[model samples]
Target: MDLFFTIVAAFTIFWFTWTYLKSKGKPPSPPGPRGLPLVGSLPFLRPDLHSYFAELASTYGPVVKLQLGSKLGILVTSPSAARQVLKDQDTVFANRDVPMTAKVLTGGRDIAWNPYGPEWRMLRKVCVIKMLSNATLDKAYALRRREVRETVGYLYNKAGSPVNVGEQMFLTILNVVTNMLWGGTVEGEARASLGAEFRQVISETTELLGMPNISDFFPALAPLDLQGAVKRMKKPMDKLNAIIESIIEQRLKKEKESGSSSAVEFKDFVQFLLQLKDEEDSKTPLTMDHIKALLLDMVVGGTDTSSNSIEFTMAEIINKPELENPLVAIPTPRLMDPTLYK
Candidate 1:
């Protein structure tokens, strides 16, 4: 046991020394905490990263270098530095260091975490230019109306009842998103059940994305996934993938039954995407994996961000209202002055 302990200590010291000497020739990093070797600043990470990063910035200048295990985290705190990366020279820094859970969730095919290059450019063009064009988005107004009407009707039905606004808003957002993707929308109990699963999955997935994983920091140990982050992530991701597959299969079956395009016309985002997929002559061909990943992206991003923002806004309004208008209340239906969403 004494010999084993000595061997371990010697190996650790040797490895740390070797690593330090190897990096000595590289350009000097920005001023920041000189954390312990091997693990670096991982031990100093806080739950509230924004505040922690702010504190670090105050001490180590706007650009702080954090050696997080085997990875290096460069903090750009200043608006000008951020602008240089985000807008001025955006393309140069378009790629991201994807986390394990995020990679598992999107199979690294999503536009959010994909490396900047030809494939990413293609995804950008497909997702942004074509899908979100004025003509395509204008078609979704009816979808928006139908969804909002359903939500209003639901609120009307649930009068004098205690409501979980966050969950309800998330469900409505998910339904709207799914409806915009494909015309088949569930309601009532089905929506409730499905929305619960989505809430759990999205919540878990996002949390895992934010969590610092041992595998991510130590690439050599990624396959092992020492912290079980990767294993935990696969569960929700598999469920999400299954949901996407079911939707795709349903659409394909419907298309086959209805003769693919028997004068019905392609209406929804799914139809448009599938039509694009069938186009074999495109230089950067869109695959089934790409379609699935993009759909998952839409579901996760749309539901999570929109619902969270709305919920926060609602909470703030409730806390300090400009007017006494509660967001989740049943509307008074007067035909005279319709303030939209009628």
Candidate 2:
């Protein structure tokens, strides 16, 4: 037992020393707050990530390198630095370092996490040209108008009463997206149930995505799920996956019953994807899994971003009387308005 302990201690020291020496020889990494051993800067991470990054940028240069456990986090603060990475050297920086939770959600198949290659290019083309082209957006304008009208009517009914602006906007955007995807197929009781379920899961998902997971920083420790972040994230993701699967099954059933003659009547994104899947294509043949993953991206991305923007804009208008009457009002820069003041 004494010999075994000595051997373990020696091995540990040797590994640390070797790693330290190897890193020492490399070109100097960007400056940031010093981190503790093994866990790195995780313990020092603040709840306000944006503010923390800002502080780091102020202390360091525009580009700050943070030691996040076994992973390296590069923070780009300046617009020029960001442009360089995103445009000047796009191909080199195209690949993403996907987290454990994201991998579980997408199976590393979705365009967001997929590596820079033919598959990603194909997926990008499908999304840009076929799904979200100008023609498709023009056709879907009516659906968006209908959902917006419904929301306006609801707000009008509750005129004086207090309303949860964010919640309402989220639901409105969610329905608009659903209608565009499948012509608002899930309706009445099922729609209510689905909306509630989706809201809960999406909230959980976004929270989990932002969290600092140990598994994300350390790949070898992912299977162990030390912080249980991956496990927690998977629950909501699985529920979402099941919902997508059920929708796909119902669509398939309808298609089978309706036959090929009704194929031309297909209107929604799901129908379009299904049709594409059936068509003989040698390059980047669409699969059902890919369809589901893309749908997940649409729901998660579309709802949160649009709803949040609307909510923020509404809040700004309500809180600031200067912008209350925008058409005739002069733009006075508020201390809070970073863009205008800066």
Predicted model with the maximum TM-score: 1
Model 1: per-residue lDDT, tens digit, 1-342?
999999999988998789779889899879999888788899999988999999999998989999899898899999999999799999887877888888788879888888998888888888786567888677777877777776766666677997778888898888778887877677878889989988999988888887878888888899998989988989988888888898888888888998864346656777777878887557888988888888888888899888889889878887877534554354755422334434
Each model's lDDT: 0.83, 0.81
Evaluated at residue 306, the lDDT of candidate 1 is: 88
Weakest 10 consecutive residues of candidate 2 by summed lDDT: 333-342
Reference-based TM-score, model 1: 0.87
Q: 251 in model 2: Cα distance from truth in Å?
A: 1.6
List model 2 lDDT by residue over 315-339, tens digit each: 9888897888863455644422433
* Decoy 2 TM-score against native: 0.85
RMSD of 2: 6.4
